[model samples]
Target chain A: MKIALDTIRHSLEGAIPGVVATCDANGIPNVSYVSQVHYVDSNQVALSFQFFNKTRGNMLANPQLTAYLIDPETAARYRLALLYLRTETDGPLFQNMKAKLAGIASHTGMAGVFELRGADVCRVLDIERVPGAEAPRALPPYNWLTVLRALGQRVAGCGDMAGLFEEVLGGLEEMLDIRHSLLLMWDECGHKLYTVASRGYVHSGIGSEIPLGCGVIGVAAQYQTPIRITHMAAEYSYSKAVRENAGLDPQRLETAIPFPGLAEPHSQMALPLLASGKLLGVLYVESAQDMRFGFEDEDGLSVLAQQIALNLVQLQQAGDVETDTAAVAVGASPAGARLQIRFYPANHSVFIGDDYLIKGVAGAILWRLLHYYVHENRTEFSNRELRLDKHLNLPDIDDNLEARLILLQRRLAEKSSALAIVKTGRGRFRLQVNQPVQLLEHEVGAAL
Target chain B: MIGSSAGIPTPMSTTAPSPPVLRPEDADFIRSGVSVCVASRDVRHVPSLARGLGCAVCDGGRTLRLLLVKSQSEALLRDLEKSGQIAVVFTRPSTHRSLQIKGSDARLETASSGDEQLVQTSFEAFADDLLTIGFSRAFTGLYYQHEKSDLVAVTFTPDDVFLQTPGPNAGARLEPLP
Candidate 1:
């Protein structure tokens, strides 16, 4: 009886090495061990091209082939009749396979030796189960349909980008049973990803950045593909190793806050958030146990990321609106403890009484907001004014204005500073300063 | 030294300039807790695989012997019977150092007295290797368990040897043993 290849995907993850058999033109057969058989789709699977061997030669001469795979959880064996298609040396599939192979190689003690030259694509003609008397019953890793349904509803209910970020991270933990995860937004100009929200870590790691093509997260964003590594590979760990390997300038690397990752992560999955052919960010997750995240986990997270990307685009589009200048009159200056606010014009780094608060677009937003409050006597602001503010230099009109505001608000709350921003309504927010404020602006390259 | 006095023909030599032969240096590497997988295909091209319990080299390194658990190798054993062709891969779990040997003449025989000890030693070494890499002892123990009665011996003469390591010169053959 023929079965669909998708139903037995656990066998393709390289937990139990696959075996491939091909016959030469002279009817001589050859069999070889396959490190991994990547599941491209229901009808297609790609084998890693690490070495030029008889199997490859036979496949080039005779496309008829057979492969055997075994499920790690259950001892069920499957036989696949395949037809050789083409080889992909680059692209999303190749990147995904390459990243995964790194982890496998490292785990098997073949880190530098195993390099992916290409992905040999094959058409799975038919799949048959190798009948065995022992039927092992193992619990399914996760119910993808159930988790996706519940997560879709949760994401849809989020009224704003902030709520969407919170719900997505929370949903991953509560609904999908994923304990550790992070959400990073893409910095297209800088070729980096900045951490905005994360769960299951001692530190939130907000504002930490990783360069594109540097680590697993960066590679996923660079190729706009999902990279899942079942074993922890030191070569792909983010932060210090990635920064050092990339040979990034120390000053530039210093600007990037260290990523909060497990000291020894055995399983990791990074999925790119792509919408309309543009990468928005990456959703990353890791575990201390080996094989904790399987193919099902990657598929589920990929679907969830698609939903998030769509919602993010929709929320950003909805944030573009006209500002209300009627409430320009600021409240009377508060009589209390003095709070010092300093802003650096060069990099937009903001500090509150010697403690660094934030920088970049969020810092610029805060600087402008405070300038209006102290000088222009404006306590209320809208997303439109911020987007239209030429001085702020937002990357685009469709910039994530609302998301930036939310991030700024959260950072302030976390710092417990005397200043706060409250959402008054859709597209509008109000600043509430509890103490007398001393605002200072510094020239470029000036020390605080 | 390309052909040498060893009977092994080094089939991969024609494909590439270098001839890769089974050498003494690779003997311990292959036998030291490396992952061993044997593969064969039925007449209709349906492949079958079974994890080898252990492996041994004899006949001046020209012949290879693989020990497999009979109960777990129903399909693979049948495939071996249908066609005398077989391929076996020996890969060090830690280094991914690998070697693939193809044989045209294959036959099954009863397990010899020393073969049980070979299986036991390989199992222990493989478990230790996996433990170093963070695999649970329980998982490894259960993964390689086999009953003494369930063992079978598969012996084949090496017709071809290929460097299965991942690199630019991976498939290149080496000179035969002098």
Candidate 2:
């Protein structure tokens, strides 16, 4: 029976390393262990090109070869009669294989020794399963397609950006059973990704930043590809690097919110939230169990990420159109102790009474909100007005006002309980503050 | 071409040593619970491979006799019958310690006296070995299970022995075999 390459994708995820057998020019056969066998498509797969070994020599001489893979879960074996194709040194496939190889190397204690030189593409001429090799097995616990559909519905039911973030993050836990996860939005101008929403952590880690091309999440965002690391490697863990990212500037170090990534996650997966080639950000999930997220989980999460990205795109565009510029500040402000709000335009850092609240775009948005509340005596504002506000310096096309509002709202709720921003209507919000406040704006400084 | 995870992957470090003889430790390691795979190629140069049930080092570590399930190794057995060249890799999962033994002459042989017990012992040992590395013993038992009647041994006098452990020196010849 002809086997489609996708049907057995779990076997190709390198959960159990595969063996590649090739014949040299003299018809002498040689076999070796391969760290990864990446599924390119229905008809092709890419093997990691590590060194110019005899296997490489044989492939150049005899393109026809055999590769044996075993399912990590079932242990069922299959043989792929592959015809060697071209090698890819760059692009999504190469990046994916390279990232996977890094994790394998780190897990195997061969980090620097195991480097991916290229991705050796192979045309799967045939796939034959070892007969009677499989023992009777129980059915899988979950179907990713059904779970993804349910997640999509949960996200679509939300009416606002905060609700959307809440639903998606909540659905990941409730529906897919992904307890530890976070939502990040791309800061295109800053060349970073910031945590907008998170779940299953003691600290929300909101406003935590990771530079592009740094850790798993950063690398995922940089290449716009999904990265799955089954075993925790020190260099790939984002928690420490995120702190470093936060401390890139001395001022940022002082104001950096604690990065809430798992300190020692055994399994980590980061899928880039991309929409039509442009990356929106990244959706990251992690666990303390070895091999928690398999290939199917990655595929499911990628689907969910795309859904969230599309909705986010729609939500951001919708924020631009739904404007009530003449909205009035309602409800009398309560009397309380005076709170001094400091705004640093350099990094858009916001602090109240020496306590840092948030920075980056969210901080800038917070400053703009406090400005109107302090001088203009306004509480209610529209997203459109904020988008149009030139002083905020938000990007013109993908301003991402909704995400910034969500971040600012979450941070304020966590840090400053007395001052909170609540959505009033579509594309509008009311900043509720019980205490009297003083606004102090500072000069621009370098940001991390 | 044969390698596992124990060696560095540097090409310069893989310079071949003199003819390798399997050490007493290699024989002991082979008899322990380690995974095995056998490779052979057809006249057309399309190689074939299959999971090995177990391996037995005979003739004071100079020859290797590998166990394979006949049903799963039809093509490989056919290749071996056509071209007697063979390469077998034995690897311990827990440590990633691996060895590749190659031969120019491979012969098909039926299970001899005590071979069934060897298969069962090797399977349990391999399964037990895998259990230490997080694989459930029961699951690995079923994965490595071999029926007595379905087993066949492919015996070969090894002409080459190489360090197949992954890393830079993976393909380097294992010299001064005992």
Candidate 3:
């Protein structure tokens, strides 16, 4: 498929996503999609890619690679970069990159990619950068798990739900440099748009309750559609609760609250969080910059919000299902002498602590250890005998068993200061602690 | 791997001794992921023991524990007397050769001697070592009487050590556990 580089560049500049590829010394092939790619120099360019899967594998095998963006619509091709293979570098590539990409980087506010690659023989230096990609979508387009994982960080491991909302809004504000961000919840019981959380807003709790079908949020909730109000005065769905409450100038409603920022809050979007046929919540995103929430942002954030809602449901359900067999006690405080403990409800979410947390196979391994301890009285088990016992309980595949345990170890390391989970000596493992660990507290069934 | 010449079986029974030694051939069997069959016989009625030896090639360490059942229940006492008079032997880890017991050792004929006996004589045999020998379910469940005891069968017990299996150069020795 020989295509003109200028045509591809123009198509990419118009709105075409790029395809990434890399090869090793052995001629092994790897490919992926890149959202952001910029030139470091005429010969080199830097690209940022989410870490995982085939791309990581290729990088490990060989760092030398090439990335290209093709515009089938215009038969244009943009040869992005041909990277140099090196673990160590002190080149002028980074400086050349900051000049070409600093403006977009500042606008997007994403971390700059450090790795650089020289240009291939064919180059289109004067090609305009495409704001969006327009092409035939692949089947099962985005890798769901990876996208979920990337978005999972926004909501996962939140200590307090309400408090995390504020933090999340702040992070989103920082990322987009939006003047204002507010999270509205349509209280199913209350039937009102209660401002549960917000950022860049006044303390008077302005525009608190927008009844169903009353305002932009109300229309969003009623019609189950997003609202992007560029002008509040002309918005028939605009209902100002603060203006109504103050009882001043019903006729001067549009002039009452002079929200210069809201009047021209260039880009705004309201996405409903629907999961399993139920609308749990809605996300309202607005930016001071014009045309900020485009189709890409709308689609991505809507999917992201949907994931959050699904995960929220999972998180709630997870609390009901005991993830860990042994319940460790929490801090002993508040009630003076009363002791408190918390067990990780069995689920994939890793346990959290200052120095230790149970994750993945580590949880499985810990579960097994606890199971054995509960079943039989043992302080230490030899590796030789442990496998025999573990095999009796699980499959005899050692690699599969160990991989899970490693996940648990990493999670534990992240959660707690104690790196003393896996011990080795005399070919046996022993849990060492004089005081009863709060981590092992749980409901004891009739059967041990 | 130095220990007794007695090798252990996989899926060890609860009654089997702990820390059972592994045999050289048993190691090969385990490594090969192969399964083996263990069998018992009554040589008196089935006197084709010599012919059966040829079929024991795939049997690895073919161990034969022959039990001589009494033809007549009453003749068990006389049989026990002779069986008790026979000697026994055992093997060591260091030496691959067999060591036999000395003198007139007697197998107890059902504690006292008033009960009916099933087998007059019982001999233990293995390719490697001799730790202990046990009776088969058929032999143990038989109707028997012991004299001067609560109706028990003639049960013979070895007093001194005896060579359970033949020599080391012929059969593999047991491997020591961790």
Candidate 4:
């Protein structure tokens, strides 16, 4: 163990193919080139087990193996002595390796053949640098530690849900120079992920819906793991995935809201925001350049995503407290023609005249607010009361309520309707109705 | 059997050398620009791997000559001494198309006068191919940079050839093109 295995992760990224050596008990050796050597932790690294080949057989019979890792940056080589720990068929490790293998395979013209079945976990038994004159160590583009700390600080300064998301995604652009990204909150009841915040797209797509398990974002959410692809593969493309999904059922309005994504992003990473094993959302980032988000970037963003998830739980729950109901003035509406506020109770869909505004739980919340406004003459409300209400049917504390409110708010702004939900304070907000609204509930067997 | 421990030994084999199974097309591919790696194991089956400078297939496509630097391949050379068994892989970086040839009896000879030109040609081809896939000239230099005086020739008659192009067909026998 002359050197730590953690620092040489660049070599293990499989940017340059790595050589893996294994042997059966007969003293006969088998050598193969592996596409990726996944950095599982400080003591272990995993290789994608794409097929049940001689290497897999040799490993199971005699776990002793050697891996020759060459740094893509420095061309420095190292020999890792690893003991086969176990093969993970499913979990964070397998899913992560599967997604990466898919990207590399497609990039290398091995698209359909490079399918991952499991992750071969190996414990680092020894590590020694192979003494050779290598290319000089090049400086990385920017210090990720500095970027991470600054982003964390920016998120720390945020007091509300909207600002928190903005600071996180905005920090990626301003600090890390990552241009395109989306922050999507998982809708548990609907089994879909809705865009709550986005950056670097022609269309904001604030209310875009992607069902769980369609594309990279959906897969990341489905497995509660990060999915990163270095090259664009049509099978994993969001446009194709959503199109295939809609082809199954074209009548569904879920596909109506176009997903804001690049046509052919070379590199993309979707990191799940996990809080105590519960997935809050997915923070997706992409670039037009190949291998743009390397292993280190994924490591940095995964930590940031977890922190964001925890902060979201705390911030959203903290917003549950009722306060500032009377501090903000509820201004009178301007004289204008009353517009029809159409509601479909079946899916909780709301329509402003003819254009679809929103649906699902967010739609239900908006309708409730409008209902109370029309009947009880109430203008201000708190998130605490919404969470306690049984009618809203909010999922658990994991990525709930506040995110939906943010979605509702963004949708209203996206549509530029007469209605607006303005945050008055930490918890209280006023529903500013610029035009008088007529409530029309459209349900089967109900008076129109 | 973990990497730290050894498993039951399958008694030492005294198998005879078999004829080359490398197809003519694969022979040409191996001789062309490709990332070459040579590997062997100690008596304990603990394998050692080393990068190859370049490669050449000769003797009517039966013999495989791989050039490795003596100074950088001490462990691999030591392992090959005890177990003549060897496995060499050649991969084209741009397409990721690859093949592996295994030899039960491998021999190391001093790099020849004519072998220098053969190795140099492959180096340029491999470097140029890697450049097309975004590898800088300096980075590609790491594989080709070696003193001609230190180059050792590892020669073996291929016993079997396997398609190692990283797909469902990987590790399968390299069938001849129809």
> What does candidate 3's lDDT look like per residue over A1-448, in tens digits?
4333323323332122244444333332333444335332334334543333344455556554445454433322343334434331222333222222222222232224312233122223333222222344335434445654654576676533343455556656654454476665544533544444556764413223445555445556665655543212222223353434354323212222222125434455666666676655566766656445433454466666775666656643333332222223323322222212233323212233332233223344565554454455334443444445543344442322322332333334434443234543323345322233333444433111
TM-score on 0 to 1 scale for chain A of candidate 2: 0.93
Which lDDT value does model 3 have at A202? 47
lDDT of 3 at A380: 49
RMSD of each: 5.4, 5.0, 36.7, 4.2
Q: Which candidate, 2 or 4, has the higher lDDT?
A: 4
Instruction: Indicate the docking level reached by candidate 4.
Output: acceptable
State the displacement of the C-alpha of residue A70, model 4, in Å, after optimal TM-score superposition: 1.7
Chain A superposition TM-score, candidate 1 = 0.93
Higher-TM-score candidate of 3 and 4: 4
- Poorly placed runs, candidate 2 (over 4 Å): A106-113, A243-255, A327-334, A445-448, B1-20, B143-149
Across A1-448, the per-residue lDDT of candidate 1 in tens digits comes to: 5699889997899876787877665445666777889899999999998877778888888887778787765667777889999999999999899988988888777788778889999999988775443345667756789889999999988888778888998988887678889988887655677788889998777777788887788889988999999998887887545646555543333253557878788999999998897888899999998878888788888898999999888887777654554656865788987789998877787888887887877888998988888888888988887887898778873356776787688778877458898988778888878788898889987965
After the best TM-score superposition of candidate 3, give how far the Cα of residue A273 lies from its true spot, in angstroms.
1.7
Higher lDDT: candidate 2 or 3? 2
Per-residue CA lDDT of model 2 for A60-94, tens digit only, reads 99999899998876778889999999999987789
Task: Provide candidate 3's TM-score on chain A.
Answer: 0.35
Error of model 3, residue B172, in angstroms: 99
Candidate 1 residue pairs in backbone clash? A109-B94, B18-B173, B19-B173, B19-B174, B19-B175, B20-B173, B20-B174
Residues A1-448, candidate 4: write the lDDT tens digits.
4688888988877687778988887766788887788889999999888878888898999998889898887888888888998999987788778878878887877788788888999999898787777866768888989988888888888888899999998899998899999999887766778899999998888878877777789889998888888887677888777767743333233655788889888899999998878878899999999889987898899889988998898897788766545433445655789899998886677889888888778888999999878777778888877776687767664347888889899889989569999987888777888888899998744422
Name the runs in model 3 displaced over 4 angstroms.
A1-151, A204-207, A229-233, A240-264, A315-448, B1-178
Docking quality category of candidate 1 according to DockQ thresholds: incorrect
lDDT of candidate 3 at residue A326, scale 0 to 100: 29
